[model samples]
Target: MSKFVIKDDFWELFPQAEIAVVVAKRIDNTEASAEPVRPDIIELLEKANEDAKKFITKDPLSENEVIAVWRDAFKKFKTKKGARCSIEALLKRVQKGKEVGCINPLVDLYNAVSLSFGLPCGGEDIDTFAGDMRLTVAEGGEPFLALGDEEYDEALPGEIIYKDDEGAVCRCWNWRDGQRTMLTEDTKNAFLIIESVDPGRSGDLRQAAQKLEELTVKFLGGTARIEFMNINKKEIPL
Candidate 1:
């Protein structure tokens, strides 16, 4: 079983933090399409966009309840908020009348769930990970390659990131995934991470995680499993 741990430093900053990890194996990545949009996935994305229109119309992206929570978290970890986290970026795009476009079946499915639930959700190809993964503040200089970028970037000190024994897998907590562990058409196993800082929305987090697992199995032809971790329970065995 692979081990996933939330470092104590992270809990000290956000005691209410929670993460849901969904693991899927034997995924059929051959169906992945960079330009194809699944009708079912499009329906979910459209509905989420419609639902988000109401909240964004009432207030700017910076003032959104869900986005605000993450903004505060970024501040606590010494990183800027907007244009960082996946959920915030998605909301910002929808707020401006842009639809989240499809990438691949796995990515599209998770993006739909993240938008529908208003939470930060991302995943990595598990086989690429070196060892057990940990969520903690960076000490600086960890290698990172943002999506579509060819050159490597360095993580800022004190920024929150997910790292394995080798190096950082994600920089700025749900902001961007590193190319080293990104999910690709060849990925056969993956670990998806959904995060929440609002204690009151634990139910929403679980619901989103369940939906992610279902969608992964439905579209990727894999067996899925999920494990939940919070301030109270910091570790889980895969």
Candidate 2:
């Protein structure tokens, strides 16, 4: 089993945070149509959009509870909001009348689960990672390649990131994924992460992770494994 570690620095700052990690292996990895969106996935996004509109109507993006937690995190980590987290980005798109569209089988499946649960969910090709994975505050100058970018960028000191032995895999927590580990049509092994700051929402987190596992296995033909971690539990074998 591979190991995934959350550093003490992160727990000390956000003790209430929780994360669900889902690992899938033996995936089909063959190219397939990600559209038109499946009926179940469409329903999930539609309902999530309705829920988001309710709170967004009452307050600005930074003030919305679901997005606020992440905004606060970004502030603590010395980064600005807006493009700080995946969930916030998705919510903003829905607020602007843009429905989340399918990207690929794996991406579409996880996006559905993310919107449904109102959390930041992301994944990477496990094979691209070097050695074990760690979630920690960067010390500065770690190499990172944001999705769709041609050049490498340096991660700021004190910013939270997920990294492997070679370099950073994700920067600013779930804000952006490094290009090297991005999931693609040839991804046979994947590591999916669902993050939540609400302490009382563990049940929802577990359900969302399980749903991702089910969807991945059903659509991508993988064997799924899951692990849960939080301030109370620091590490898990993947």
Candidate 3:
């Protein structure tokens, strides 16, 4: 059995931070990815886009509380020159009045929850992971083939990353996902991650996790278990 471990290196930076994991199994993520998107999923995503606006009160995007906290966190470690957290990317689209399109059932549901809660959320195909996965600072030179790209973008030393024995699964924290473990319509088992660095948003974090868990099983026909971790609870079976 593989395990997911959050290293001490990560906790040393943000002691109050918490990570929520939703292990979803036996799900069908392909139904909504066909040529025509499902109406219910579309409605869910549209509402989430509108709900995301509540977190962006500042005129300038970066000045918002949610975006600012992540920006400051990125500065604490080495990251790619222009890399930004996933939440920033999603909220920016909402700010521009651009709706995020549906990818797959599982991805769409998680994205909706992420946007609605204003937290960084991501996932990986559990079956694709090489071994035990970890959230830690990279040692640099770890292999990373970004999604939709043909080349490798190696991880930088001191960069926060989610990795398995094969190499980097996600580079620059949650900024990007590597193709090796990215979620696809064919994926049956998945590892979803909802990250919270702002201590004040702990309530939002739990709510987001619960929402994601409910959506996963409802739309995808699966069983999901939610796990929360902090400095004290650092590991869980994957």
Candidate 4:
């Protein structure tokens, strides 16, 4: 059976960390690849970019609470050079007066929620995962082909990763996702996550999960269910 499991190895690093999940089924993402982006989705992204500025309390991006928390977490594990949390990537773009562009319907919607909620949000195609999905520290050398890369790379030992029976699904926690299970226009069922390393932001993590579910159901025509994974709960069947 396919399930998403957070191994104890990961919890050993950040015991109080919370990962919020949303499993969406029966989605229609064809519009994400359309030439002219839907006007409503465009507005949603624009507002989110503007709203994200509230979290930018410090001049340097690293000083912000959300960015700093992830930065500290990454230091506990090995990661690729220059890899930063996905939320930092999005917030950086917004901080520089640049808008986070749309990728696909599901991606754009999650990016919107990520920006608005100030947490790292990501998703993958549920059908593409090989057997169960796992969150753990890599033993090193799990084959990985990142999004838009022609050659394959390997996950570093001691790095935080999400992997399946086939290979690595995401590397360095939420920094980058692999192309093997990437969400695309043809995707119908999706598994989404919003991660929080700081215990103080637990409320924000939960709010992001709800907002993501609302947007996925409203725009993608799906039945989305939300779940929280922590020390007490570690797995959910896909």
Question: lDDT for each of the candidates?
Answer: 0.83, 0.82, 0.92, 0.92
lDDT of 1 by residue, 159-185 (tens): 888998888898888888888888888
Model 2 segments more than 4 A misplaced? 33-55, 80-83
The sequence of per-residue lDDT tens digits that candidate 4 reaches over residues 73-185 is 98999999999999999999999999998888889999999999999999999999988999999999999999989999999999999999998999999988999899999
Question: Which clashing pairs does model 2 show?
Answer: none
Candidate 2 residues 1-238, lDDT tens each? 5688999999988888999999999886555443343565556656766665654644577678878877777777845244578888888898889988856678877888888778899999988888889999998888998998999988888889999888889988988888899999889899999998888788989999999999888777769988899877898776
Candidate 1: C-alpha lDDT: 0.83
Error of 3 at 80 (Å): 0.6
TM, every model: 0.92, 0.90, 0.97, 0.96
RMSD of each: 2.3, 2.4, 1.6, 1.6
